[model samples]
Target: MFDDATPVIRRRSPKSQRRRDGLIQFAHDFTSQNGEDGILRHIFEAVLPPNENGIRHCVDVGAWDGRHLSNTFSLLVGPKHESITIAHDQHNDGSWIGHHDSRSIWRGVLIEADPGKFRELQSLHEPLGNTCLNVAVSSNAVSESSLASILQKSTVQQTLPLDFDFLCIDVDGADYWLLHDVLTNTSYRPKVICIEFNPTMPNDLVYIPPCNDNLRHGASLAALVELAEMHNYLLVETTIYNAFFLPKHLYEQCFQDLVPDTSIEALHETTMVTSLYQLYDGTLKLWGCKKLLWHRLPIEEERFQMLPPSQRNFPFAPNITSTTTEISDPVVDISAYCQSQVTEPLHSRRECSSQLLEQLKSHGFALVHGTGISAQLCRDALRMTHLFLQEADESVRRSCMSIRDRARRGYSPINTENFASLIGEQGPNDLVRKFRIGSESSTESSLLQPNIWPAPSEHWDEETCDEFRSVVEAYYDAICIAANSIVQCICDGLLQEDEGLAASLDFLSSSNSQQSSNQRNGIPTTGLAHKTSILTLLGYQTGSRHTKKHHKKKRAVHPLVAAHTDVGVITVLLYDSGDCAVLQRQVSNSESDKGKFKDVVLPYPVPDDPIFVVNIADCLSALSHDTLPSTIHRVVPAEGSIPRNCLALFVGFDPDQELKLKEGKTVSYETWRKDRIAESQKVLRNRMSVSKS
Candidate 1:
């Protein structure tokens, strides 16, 4: 819930009524926008009235020439000043002046990084008795160039009050970081603050670009609001480029009766950016400006054509329409299919394989029952994962960070991955914690990294830790068996359709020459052996109470995982029963059905049988020459849904195996994997670093 209270009856005080009715009449701007000059004048009248002979102080970072787009200039030099030319020969000797009223003087400290602009700023402000500093401000607390340190070096330090009346931060890049550092590292709590926000960003998005001085992209309004709330500030107003905030106590004292709606959505008035929509048919549509000012990328085209191409559109199964009817026919009886391989006739075996392949080709995913994994095993795995994630100490989890093991192993805390970036979108990080279990390598020189396990701690005993490892390994092995059988079934079905097509995928079969070579080299030769064939145990916990309250609103859907396609050949997902975790987009040719993402349902023929949902991944689409296409899927919090636990098995190919593609060109699996991983990791590292800083 928001901190600002909505009054039952909207009533304004005499001063509040006067401020509102006269805002437009008195709206005179030296540099401020959106009538901020008038608003600040009214605010100061209530907080530190000019008639009361009260001295006021204000600080402005990135104050270029102290007038260009400056929010505090009108307060320092009275709003009535029209055009007072700055003299370059004016003495730097600080001369005191009362600009607003003869009885009270406004003291200011204006800091600018550009030398040329700082000189102009000094010429304009030094004669008016304001301190002008030519120094770049950093967020680093210990640095001499930090805002706190620079404030102390200002010429008006002796006269400056501990708690200034107002502070303006307009550094284009890392504005949020600089403001956060000043609030957290210093004792100065300004009554009013104004900071710039990226107007091109959607109001709902909370994005902060990497903390690099060279990058000028500012933080989103929502990001600033979240930070303000943490510092006990309430967002009161926003212009096209800047947002204004006041401390909660001050807002209640000064403007509670004036500002009717203090909610972020109500306060933000800028709507310059377009919404990016991913249609159900895989088309990307931009409804407004295509240029991303933050990234400096111009999208000349209005619409991106459907991905995976129309030629690759698989015929939908008779029962698998674009409806949430809970069709049960997509669940392939894998145990029966495997039993037919040895006991039934060859035709029967072929029929089952064909059914399994049809489900994958039609829906881009299929739920398989009887994968040699038991329901109890899945429950135990989930139980252990929950225990480990909930009981482990913070230090224990940090010690097992995934990046310590080539980003493939160990415990990954919540929000560690940003799936949206994988698809060139910007949003919050995925809210899933994971612990990965990798295949055991036979040789010491193998490229496979060893999985990291948590040691016994006060949270859990040594016995519990050992039991956790055993249960997780068992679940991983079981899923690997199911994944291998699924891959072979697809291969068999492909052979029936086109032998040449299936022959191209011979390396994926366990009995192929590639497996024999891997065995001779003491490498993992399983049907889906690769460094990325990982079994990841995932846990999604309910977020903060405030977040839960927000999501509970009607028709509000919060994404647990942003829309993305898997990176490997195929992925096998097993989730706890009764949890609606995954939703698959309906890729169809019908325009009416576009933009619909239906919940994936696992049909259980028997009560105790284990069902595993399997989906085609990017690598398989490439290796199959687009005969099969990957699907875009995401996880959202289901209504009345509790915290969920799930397992994902990403089956990939051997690192050294060369995969031939549509063209004559061939690329090793390692090279392809690294390219994709690098792109996502670059974004992830930048996001993680910004969050930490």
Candidate 2:
């Protein structure tokens, strides 16, 4: 089966200069032919032990142009080439094996369907004694026969533990089926597998048949993981559109405690960038794991620029270049400018209500200085968050992901990790630590879901685990108390006959009474009412390269949170770093100050003080009919290696409850909330559809 003629390659000097002018000479050689050279190198280094010597064979399916973006390039031309030998073998048993050479044998079979590319591949590797075939790999017996013939010729099957070193599958349309057939029907399984995944689709376990060329060209990570498990493999790493799987037996020896169990939580500990969507069949689809397309592919950059503000998948906000100087003279103390009221200690309980209301009505936001919240409470929450995310193994954190509770009410890793491989910038994992103080469901028909949590043993000792739970619960109670006081203050300031706020207060009081009564009477209850609020503990890591270079505001801005108004009634934010919370005055479209509001950067509060930035939300603003503007604010991502943390208490009411308003007006908060959420979801859906198209 071997071709008689030897093909020659056109090689250039390592330091050769391009003949641009044909006059003067410079001493810089061209970059390598392989665009994915570095990534492949890193992957091999991780899989292969440091100083061992043996034959390393690989199979490159869809091996177009051989060295161009070839996953097996490093094995052929890297600095370790001298240690490797190459040859070809045709045994008496009618079997064919790609040849091998010296100290460390390196040989590979490159399969290319396109005739021109196959010729190029043959020419590139013929001199090295490797094999290149012009054939399409498929689930059909004919396609597999080529591989079966070659595998039997080699002693690779006898090389137990590592049948072959690496296998790269990239057939574009039928990769999943091909890999499945190879693993299930044949004995040649590589120690390491690098397969292309569908970056445009969701991460659901969806597999498309090879004949379905009209659908997505690749399989989802879910599908791949299922296949891997069936074939005695485990996913170890994921690039933009590629997943790396190693033999299940080899993972423990290579990575060990580096990777936790294969839970979604463990996966997130490695990277936080994900593109999520839901298919019509009700299965959630996801794309982009570890590396986002924004970094992996250049084509995404062009598309990202074309997306509108509402449709764009920004980690935070856009148009942050608007300056504060245009809206107001830079105030040294933004807290003073906001005219915040001191409502802590409850001092008289009823005495400080008016001051809180006036400040809220005038500035749209205010700093509430109180004794209820302490540094220790904030630290406890942040410490637990860091311990779960940074200190624990990735798998431990992944174990906490609750697919059923998609609002992700516990330890959720939101989009925080950078597309480091693509963008050359890597940041710490950004975990959105969530804790619920009340029921998650709104209606009676819905079952109330308890908070999702990580397994205690996954991260800490039993003693520390008990303390973690206690401290978090204590902080939850403290924030709830502080937030309740602010709600009462709002009720006192805005309503003449505040029955709605009184009813809410009554509900809380009666629920506590019922719980106490139930415990006293030995009757079981859900503890709190069917409606409650949430406290979001966020770790905003340093800004990514895109935010740093593109989104710098007059004041620093975090991309994790962008220029948008809060969705709830009121957001009580505890800022832990620099003047991170920036607020802009709401200017009506008819006013001269219309667009000018974008310029104002709300000033920072006194550092290390127990100052809670209380900002009014859309619900209150909608109820007031723009009389009380919902301030537009954003958290500017901190720069450099310095990470920032914040605790925000979102005060909300029963969605089903109707609001009693001024002039005998009545409104259902649920209706308005649904409309807003629907509109945003529509925009995002449209964007995803258009992007895929």
Candidate 3:
């Protein structure tokens, strides 16, 4: 994922704020039509509204720290105008705003109503309008204790024709309700309203759970539209949850005024955009997706040029882009599904060992061969001259892996007599040949070049290479420890029935061996050890494009290898990085063994190859699921170098270890795979029981 947090470019500076050309253009576009709001939301998706009109009369409810009021006044009034902005919230005093004015003629009122938050919204900003309201706007009248309402019967001249010009609402949970009440009750309403219609929207996704969680409760867009119309006000456009609205009169005139003011060609009208927003029928809200107002809408260059950095949301964040919800059912909790799989009769998740389950979770395991195997281990035993010679010898080894027959390279077996005849020449079920990850080979020609890894470094002394390998060996050994721990856990209760040999074999041996003398004691007659001994080499086969899906990285094989949920657990044996690990399923004879186990050879990027840069870079650049805080290592394959000498070791597991994770602790949709597997098993068993009944 892209981790870079820096903006592509810094925002425009302060001297540019004086330009009204851009603001006029944006204002025109924003109010162009009923849907012009969409155009405005798009441009201001990451920007603040222009405050050039001054804060002469403003109202902000739930304006913690007075940040909104502070920003509006700073950009527009800037102490030059008789602006009176009120910051009213149930939260904090004005300290969080981080700005103060002394010997200045800035006028405003600060009101804190919630008794619990009286001390916080408790700042004194101006010498006028020291009144604070005790009542909270609710479905019904309600008051908090800390705020003692002191109502003096003021005449109509003093309070009735109250001039509340611009209004901003930020109270959560009750925003729509409160805004509805204020618009309906007040005789003289504000000209512009900034209400948090969808809080935790398009912004603040990290702090709040995905907005879809809200849909589950029904406090959604349908509610917003309902509240809007009751007050003769229409819900304007929105950027995230900050919904801007205006009375029918103002809404019409505002856009009507801005339409003819357009001078900049880049500034676009919002009519078409609003139509698109309404077309989804609440699907966007249900999925917790946000409409990006920036790409479609435009702001006057000067207005966008003046805002501070904090006001803009960085749209380029890695996970900030569009997300597709893969959850199949909204009502089904993940944990319950997983638990069902575990407890289901016959098809219980416990049917597969936990080790197998884990292998399924990681897609596949890293096939590690015999331990203590690394390049350095071989170098320490050899003389320095021989070390250099061995490296050179590996360079010439590429030609040894070419396939003369096209069918073999494709993993497509040739027919009857030809398959038999070729089996004798090959001597094994399948051969491990060096193949490139991005190898371009056709049936017309032979590919003889070797794709060895870590092209030999002529600059390093053999002893140095040995030392590096020794360290790598230690790391590899640690991974082996982790693998063995998993295998041992799986094999723990497994070796109980008929020596606990895979429960599949017990029926075969006892009865058949019991009647024959070849049954030594309780052991089976077919030579229990020989019958159970199966070798499967899992290497990359010659595969066309059944590529990995939903993967951030494009792995050579199918997307499921890296991104798809695994169907079953598997035991991996490594022949080599480029070497093929062939699995023989049911071979009747030596020659059949080669044919029984299909070829699956994984290709690797080698040093000195052109693809080496692209593939190795991708692997190193990719990130891991868990943030281990442990070391991550990568070696860049250089050009004009010897092929890399690499070996990988893999552990064992059952192929069908499927279990869903419970919802409680699981983070995201990753818990879905286990969820789906669990659901299927549970449903399968329930169906089976009903049939029996």
Candidate 4:
């Protein structure tokens, strides 16, 4: 109904002619609603006469629920108009954050992703040629060449030469990563670009000043932006919700059209009041032509007071002067820079949770927390991880020297299926190599496959390899992120010993950035960081190893011992990827089925149901946060089988550390077992041998 939304955008009035009042109203309406940066907001703004070239070629990244698409399209095609084919990632999705109906194109080809959901969604959108990928978007470390879709049926990739009058990219969280991996790497560059309003999105969320996930300095909003000008793009437009980049040709035409006739100057405030915010219908809107005013809500006002005046907005700075405080856009030394930022103290629990979640989603949930994992999720993560590690080239894993057990296949989970797929399609030797992934236990002297463990070897190198890896990786990442969720739940005073305890909000600061790199690289830090992350996330001050463990050489130190009390108050441990072993001594008489009853007891017997998920690694997080015992623990050595390599998250609690002599009642483990002292001496002697030998 409204096709004329583009041409007259900024055409000038002739010198001999006086402009009509309608033109003024039109420009005013355009600037007031649609904004000068060339975003399509409302129909009234789109209806404003365009010069010659109409709006064409658009891209919106982080297009949460396609709200921006709906709003922008309304300006071009009228509120109720249908859309036309615009080239985009055929499997792109925006449903998790919000929902928007597909207008122009087919129902949007995305992977149905599951046995059930895939079937359901496929049935629902079969009319749209079965758009919508059901498979999860994995971490983006992978390149297009390594796609897991090559052999998968029902998978369709978008072929280029796919012309589009408009383009929108709304891939959320991974904006920067996606920018580098996809848009910049691809041949497609549009007349306009719409980037999502991520906290770390390029222009606005460039670089949050290096703090522990806190918004201490808003530098994270703008990084290497000046360098972007070299990329044939400049930070020409910005909004609180989205940013726009105009091609040089579009810039000239816009200015030429607005020449002598319009009162606006070059990139001048267009009297547009909106920024990267939302439209009337709650869709995100970006950069305004007119400057928007602000109201500091009580919360905002308080935040403003907390921050220094200099850190606040520019009001508008045509050019930001380079000063001592001005962060130089140096080539970021990834290792050094990452370390420096992580060294800073953390923010409150809310800040930490928010930032971590953003990071997880940004990295396509690449990491797994050692603590706070549900048993089933943890098992699934482990199964997936083992597959990736086993399938990878042996040379790669050994060269990398598989550190602590966190990384599976030496890369993030998102890249797994593709790698597995890569190995799967290769020649026989390569296939045998990939399939041999957990076939032989390095721990065992025998070159024998363990029972019930050959499936990964059998399928890892098969044609459907990458697809399986993709499926497994999702489960792995979900558990890792979920671990943090559990931690957050606890720190907010949710993981309580008192079931009747009312919920309380405790604001805890951000702790250091604990990377997997930290763990695999060291034995001590693995256990320490895992423990500290949980406590830190729970609002504790275990910030930077406030306590130190010192070993005095040549000095006598005695083993600290205490008689068992009801397992004392609780402690928690988070695992990365390895296992933890808890050894206990029991007399021969403390027996179950003629075997030694465990000195260390499990809360419950292991479940036999195949679907049952019991992650021994996350056993620590499962313990109540209070009144748990301070059990003796140490890292299980990293020898293959003889040494028993495993991921262990331990929770130790001490209600009281005072001495108690168990004189009357037979000792717990000894109650049923016999020859307690002799057995104890034998176990201790064996441990001593391992320690010395």
Best by TM-score: 1
lDDT value for model 2: 0.52
lDDT of 1 at 454: 75
The better-scoring model by TM-score among 2 and 4 is 2
TM-score of each: 0.47, 0.41, 0.28, 0.25
lDDT of each: 0.68, 0.52, 0.30, 0.28
- Winner on lDDT between 1 and 3 is 1
Q: Please write out the lDDT profile of model 1 over residues 600-683, one tens digit for every residue.
A: 765322125667788888888777776676777787765433345677888877777787776767788888777776877687
Ranking by lDDT: 1, 2, 3, 4
Top-lDDT candidate index:
1
Residue 655, candidate 3: alpha-carbon lDDT: 19
* TM accuracy, model 2: 0.41
Q: How many angstroms is residue 13 displaced in model 3 relative to the true structure, after the best TM-score fit? A: 27
Kindly list the per-residue Cα lDDT of model 2 for residues 278-299, writing each as its tens digit. 4332334344452444446332
Inter-residue clash pairs, candidate 1: 280-595
Worst 10 residues of 4 by lDDT: 534-543
